[model samples]
Target: MSELRKTPLHDIHQSLGAKMVPFGGWHMPVQYSGILDEHRAVREAAGLFDVSHMGEIDIKGPHALDFVQMVTTNDASRLHAGQAQYSLFCNHNGGIVDDTLAYKISDGHYMLCVNASNTEKDFSWIKRQCTPDFDAEVTNVSSHYAQLAIQGPKAVGILNSLADKDLSSIPHFCFDYANLDGIDAMVSRTGYTGEDGFEIYLSPEKAAQLWQSIMKAGEKDGIKPIGLGARDTLRLEMKYSLYGNDISGETSPLEANLGWVVKFHKSDFIGKEALLGQKETGIKKKLVCLIVDGREIPRPGYEVYLDGRNIGLVTSGTKSPSLGRGVAMAYVENGLDKEGQSLQIMIRNKGVEARVINPPFYKKST
Candidate 1:
């Protein structure tokens, strides 16, 4: 087997006594103190994460906007400079290539933040689409930057203390260039944990310094370094889809409950025809959220049953630390995905009762 890659913060994670494991071709921290503690910390106070493993691809040229609009499902024409939008790259058959965040730096330049494991593959797929007719150039720029996420109710306050600019002014899904304690970085008001947060992108060399600075600044606020274990649970509680698990190359964004990002009104895109056809024909199955009964945790690949007949399988599942119960996202027969529909998940050969519920098992109190 090939050697696994390590992020710039790998040594720091090791020094902090993090449990390291292989994930998406990188050795990443699975937990620091513990999954439950870190999960609660993010939900209540704040938590930091090293997400440098994610990929960044830069597209630049006069035709960048046209290229971006053709490749992604979302309408890039609505995005102004300094803004980002969640979008998807779909295959010709309407299957997902990868869900991504498209950051519009300017009219001539754009950046795509994609999942770690699909970075190289996505880059190749993107390059193949840039024919001689299109003047855009695609470059994988993942190595040039390191990413850190400070998330939770207290996240903005903590980051504001260290940033030269007011972080609260940056609207959701928008970004700005800022200096944080002498570190030049791009701070985006976005996160996967379904909380108020900022994702800082800075030089790899300054990553450790910025991480330490943020930790110290938020010390009194009860900030903790979170790991992948809690990260999964946090996003799971919010019903956010993970690339490989919840959605894959075989799933369409419409069936995954991500139709909001697919704009059929836009000019032409990769899978426009196929998606339009699917829409006209109606979707046969849909991804739904489930609140599992009792303490039994549903896991990926677990079978879903409706009246003892197999209908689908769980895509992502966990015992939610925030909700204190097992929650899951699964694809089920289209007509049976109602808010109060009843279903069962086969766990350890025994059927566990679960009910289809509207998304987001955990919501912060207002």
Candidate 2:
């Protein structure tokens, strides 16, 4: 068996008594104090996450924009310098290669943040697309940096104390290079927890320092070091899609409820023809949010039933700490994917009642 990789913060996590587990080829922390406590901290105050296991790829050259536009589903031309957009790399058959965040550093330079498990596969797929016709170069730069996420309502104030520049000036989905606690880093106003936060990218050597600094700065704000367990529940509450579970190589972006990122008006892309054809023919199944009627938590691979027939399967599910109810995301037959539609999730050979609901089960009030 291959050995598991450790992030720069692995030792720190151990020092803090975190429960470690293997995740996406890395030895990551599954929980610190506890899943529920950490989850509540993020929703009410602030929480920090070590996300250095994610991959980063850099693309640069004269034809970078053209190459990116051809490879990704989103229109890269729409991004200005210092801005980022959620996008997807699709196969020729319209299946998702991976969903990514594309950062436009300049006209000819861009960065892509991809899932940890799909790093090498995504890099290889991207490199193969760089033919002699396009003057673009792709480089995997994951090892050069470490990432940290400080999330929640109190996140801005905590980060502002250490950031040299006013973090509020960086708008959502945008980033800026700044000095964070004397460490040079790129700070982006983005997060996976569906809360206000910043994702900081810095040298791997400075990661542990920044992590400790942030914890110290947020001591009075009831900040806690969150782990993967809470991270999953947090994103699930917001109905954010997980790369392998919610959407995968077998799923199309349109069917995953990610059509917003698939721009058809732009020039042709990798799966444009297949997607257009699917659009014309109609989507057969769709990803939808389901609120369980009881406490039984629906799990991935659980069968979804309607009228005594299996129609779909749960992709991601959890008992939402914020909503205090069982929630899930699943792909169901298109006609039955309406609001308040009744369905059943087969758990332990017994069907648990569930109902379809619009996503974002929990939203922070303004």
- Residue 227, candidate 1: C-alpha displacement in angstroms: 0.6
| Candidate 2 worst ten-residue window by lDDT | 357-366
lDDT of 1 by residue, 1-366 (tens): 789999999999999999999999999999999999999999999999999999999999999999999999999989999999999999999999999999999989999999999999999999999999899999999999899999999999999999888989999999999999999999999999999999988999999999999999999999999999999999999889999998988999889999999999989999999999999999988999999878999999999998889998899998988778899999999988999998999999999999999888887789
TM-scores for all candidates?
0.99, 0.99
Q: State the lDDT at 70 in candidate 2.
A: 91
Q: Model 2, 1-366: lDDT tens per residue?
A: 699999999999999999999999999999999999999999999999999999999999999999999999998999999999999999999999999999999989999999999999999999999999999999999999899999999999999999888998899999999897889999999999999999999999999999999999999999999999999999999989999999998999999999999999999899999999999999999999999999899889999999789999999998999888989999999988899999999999998999999878887777
The C-alpha local distance difference test score for the whole of candidate 2 amounts to 0.95
| lDDT of residue 34 for candidate 2 | 100
Span of 10 residues, lowest total lDDT, candidate 1: 356-365
lDDT for each of the candidates? Answer: 0.94, 0.95
Stretches of candidate 2 off by over 4 Å are none
